[model samples]
Target: MTLRPALATTLALALTVTLAGCIAPAAPTPEPEVSDGLAPFFEQGVDWTECGEGVDCATIVAPLDWEHPAMGSIELAVSRIAATGTARGSLLVNPGGPGGSGFDFVRDSIRYVASADLMEEFDLVGWDPRGVGRSSAVECLDGAAMDELLFGQWDNAYETKAWVTELEAAEAEYAAACARNTGPLLEFVDSGSTARDMNLLRALLGDEKLNYLGFSYGTFFGTMFAELFPERVGRLVLDGALDPSIGALDWFAVQMKGFDDALVAYLAFCVGQGNCPLGGTEAAARSTFTNLLDTVDAKGIESADGRALDSATLGFAIAAALYSEENWPALTSMFEEVAVGESFIAFQFADSYYGRGGTAEYDNNSFDVYTATLCLDDDFQGDEYDVRSGLDAIDAAAPLVGGYFAFDDYAHVEAACTAWPYAPKKQPGMYDAAGADPILVIGTTNDPATPYAWAKSLAGQLESGVLVTFNGEGHTAYGRSNGCIVETVDAYFIDGTVPTSDPNC
Candidate 1:
């Protein structure tokens, strides 16, 4: 939330398949004076026009509010690669971003990463979520402004009353910036609506039950689906599942710890890595990292993208890179560059997280929707006192990255939501999958993004959540080069047979 769109989960068996009847949300919040109701533009209906070779483009017109499918429609962009040889029906795949672009992701990645076995059996379908990517995207702030707000600030301590004051001010600035640019769609862009949109995709695909593979935050989407329509889920792979119940503060704080955990493991690996500067002794790496941040803090470094890298920026870059092992060498190499007085790694890491390249542009659906959903689902206590406590917790959890910065983030999203358009429709049980199936929950022991412990804790909560542990690092377990994890997920999808016991990777 304060950082990125990340992914986990647990479950019990005995799922009584039934759609818990539900109605749509009430009349949409009236447009505020600032609301310049810019009705979105998207083409609906199936067409084979956009696919490069075999893909097809179709749009599903979903309700701006599912309660009133007629009130207004959000056109979800869809892409399909029909079953290559045979048809086991359409297998819908969602890449983890709560704000991830399914259309672009599948169009680009499906052909590359998906195993040939996966391709031959099921038609791959990817759709951009409610107000993300090609599906009525939400943009707030110019690319530059977001780069400033999201990555510019630093120092995690928010303990003092004075710092809390600064946190509020910074949050106000960020919220005001978003409120200024993001339009009408931000109000109704919660995960529930996105879930309904998925169901529509199910209907459009003409599937008796939805066969799905949801990674990272997409796993939460899968969980929401199972909870909303257990009967509809067919051969689901909720990989890298996130526990919806954790508050933003808790979720992010856990993420901070995840990074700390990952950093330790990374350092240990670095000790073995010949070129590791911060390798053998964490004290040395810690000092090197701190000094780099301090150096950048005192005098910013010009990044590859030509943006100045401050301490906070460098810190986020470091955190983002450590999310996966693929990025680990890059991260170490980046830091190694810094160790040698080069700023390119700083720029690269920043580019990876902010998605800023020469050709890259601003799209805040991820940021806006991140805040919109988190601010509500997190169920924050707006009390300044409570915030102080959370700040202490962050500092306690992550002394290096905690204190004011994280606490401010915890309190900030909800700060503007004080006057936000909507309220939480469901109770703050974001992690609860009531009558759900045997959900497979995986977490890397040293994961920096979603963190592993939450996975363990979530396993304890869900009815049939089995915990699969990866004694490694990164975001979701699926995409990483772990053959064991990939095989297990493939098997689960092919034959509803979960591993007899959680395997150690």
Candidate 2:
């Protein structure tokens, strides 16, 4: 139950949009056309009425492919929460899935994520980015297929060609499924197009500037926004910022190391606590966890959940679970429980890492979109040797723990893009965008997902970007905890106050 997928804390390595004219300034493109074929899905002919409280959902068409605007069109589903009370402006919030749903993100966890105060001042905006929830999504491998694949024995017997074959089959099955249900939407889901959609939303929102609050990969969405329209950036918060410079392999490898770091952090916390089952020695627990992985690899364990636990999946599960501190206690409990008599602890971690669909099957979107975005964005070598090298580094960085993190899992994203049905338009600054106002960036020291190094990279990349550090343990900060973090963020939003210096939370 490590939940490192939160990838929020590691982002503290640091701390840590755009524009348009208003008031009848620009001419309307020849009237916008309905996104081809997928128009009905986005317009939601099923529900003519908008879908939320104080919100309206609609379709805005942009070129199916930005590069060939006149040739094709694609529709993005959008939702907006108009300003209530005294309004500051439209604040678009993204919950970092690359595949995550932003539609209801504002209310997902108002108390801990979007502060009540911030909500009152700004009109909350959320959307199911192109190929994500509520928004027309990509679904090749449904839940049941994913469940079967999730419990497979890859982490341990990966040494065998059978497991490698299994992984290859799974990867292909997933890709084919996407082709069946997703059609050409995959081409449009890339971050750059999403940013264009954001601009359109900003225009429709009638906001003078784009006020954005992006979490996890959402940070990249925000950065792209800034680069696209630097003048339109209002108050922006990037939590668990991603390192646009890193390739997918690097992202995966670094994330593995991030988990190791957070795991040690958890061990240190457990060792000192009187209730800690691992006792008060983090180093001992570290050894214990490693030994458990080795033990499970050799002899699988049974959990209360009635599932047989092996090393690979457990490692993957725990690595994912450690992304946020909120998941730490649960992780510790599971590890302790597994040590005692239940192997089901691994299943618990799996459930959290990959939530079930309404049909009781797990969603593979994380695995899918994760692949789509990273693959499309990075120049993946697809060379097994190159990927193995990164994985080896993770393994060396932290023995028993890094193997799961190895970047070789599904290195095909980039490879697939090579044969993508359509051409791709690499954004102007897929990684580097220098010169601009100080972009206040926040990174949670314990973030397991995006990791702190990403924050540092982001700060270093943006000429005017300043790094703000949050000492807490969570996925995204600002509203997650710490009054100081909140105040600093609010100032940036209201007064354009970039931290005079990086504030270490």
Candidate 3:
């Protein structure tokens, strides 16, 4: 199983249903005065065309290599809605996939992503980062190859030499496909480069400083921006933050524990509901769930499409639902359907997580870019022995969920990195964005994807960080969370008001 990093469910059914209202496109803005190697990129005008009702779409060009502008350029897809009221500046947003389509987020789900107040005061902008949808993306497998990669059966049992060899071979094949298809672009898709791209966008958009709202993995992107151009920071809100200092193994371990804890929390709520499908008690529910997983692992259930519903896919479905409390009822429905030997609901959840469609093609290149970006951004801090020890620790932290994540000693995790064609471009370390404006960092106490500890870690690391804590569940806190979180964040952006202290809501 590929243990990907924390991803925000901006495309979740609940949020995506809320369509952002459009406004008349504003007149073209003039370019900022600039003279540098990157000046042409900043001075180039964006030719915006109305793609939707009042939403304008445009493409901006940035250097493929920031250090050397002569290397060539890549196109970045951008979309925006003009402010209803007079605009202070553009409010750039990222829904956080590392590969999430910010352009789609703005075009489709702006109301859900941003508050009405903020949208009225500022032009809401979204863009697909490098190697993402609608931009210069990383392409590897087609639908059939993707299905085999994500859901194909493994005949071998756990921990054997056969299993290890098979896993390593599969990872190598995938890496080779990425290298062969993506070419040199694959090496520069890391968050560090993306952050540089954002700065260029900020300048091209005619904003004096960046005003960004980044969720989940976008938090890392935002932090990288802050670290790189501390003086250019304006109003930045990083919700569901990731601690950039942590290495790959720790990222896996904490993510597993977070999901495990979230599962426990869900069970606590589920058992109290009428006709709860799992069991009467949390422990009973866990036992029932594990048994179900074991049964699925041992003998998979065949879906109508003839695909097997195995333990790994079930785990993905579970993780997908755990992203939001709003999705808990869907989890219960999945459990109920699977109990009756129906894999439809489970498959639906898993497919959404993977961005797969009913047709052969995927909706986007998220899965491909997710892996590519991760391999480049992650710091493999140890060798094979250290990796083995780390995997054991992960299993210990999440005794129930971790097993589903791995078959045995997960040498495959490290093996994938070892076989990756490119070296990691960004090193893992603390980012103290000194000389920057006060940045608001928000964290949910029980976020399944990005654990709450990461928020505290990031907040402490930033020299001008002000933490807004939400003592609740789910992946992010700003839009879906309580009034305290929404108000704190909205006030920070709309007005220049930073919280005096953590509300601890």
- Which structure among the candidates has the greatest lDDT? 3
Candidate 3 per-residue lDDT, tens place, 185-225, comes to: 99899999999898888877878799999988889899999
lDDT for each residue of candidate 1 in 114-217, tens digit (9 for 90 to 100): 66667777889988887777787665667666666665554443245775566566666665665566665666777777776777677656676788877777
List candidate 2 stretches off by more than 4 Å: 1-56, 154-156, 160-162, 302-307, 357-360, 381-387, 405-435
Q: What residue pairs are clashing in model 3? A: none
For candidate 1, give the lDDT.
Answer: 0.63
Best by TM-score: 3
Candidate 3, run of 10 with poorest lDDT: 14-23
Candidate numbers sorted by TM-score from highest down: 3, 2, 1
lDDT of 2 at 178: 69
For candidate 2, lDDT tens digit of each residue in 1-505?
A: 1121234322212110122232222222221343555333233221113444444555556556655555566556655554456877778888776666665454333324655667677767777777765566666675666656655445436545554445555566666666677887776677888887777667656666678878888898889988877766766778788887765556666766676777778787777665677665766777777778777656657644444576666776676666667767777787777776565556765665555534446543656666566545555534344333544555766565556634234333433443344444475644444444567788878676667878988988876678889876656786566888988887787667778788786
* Model 2 CA RMSD to the hidden true structure, in angstroms: 6.8
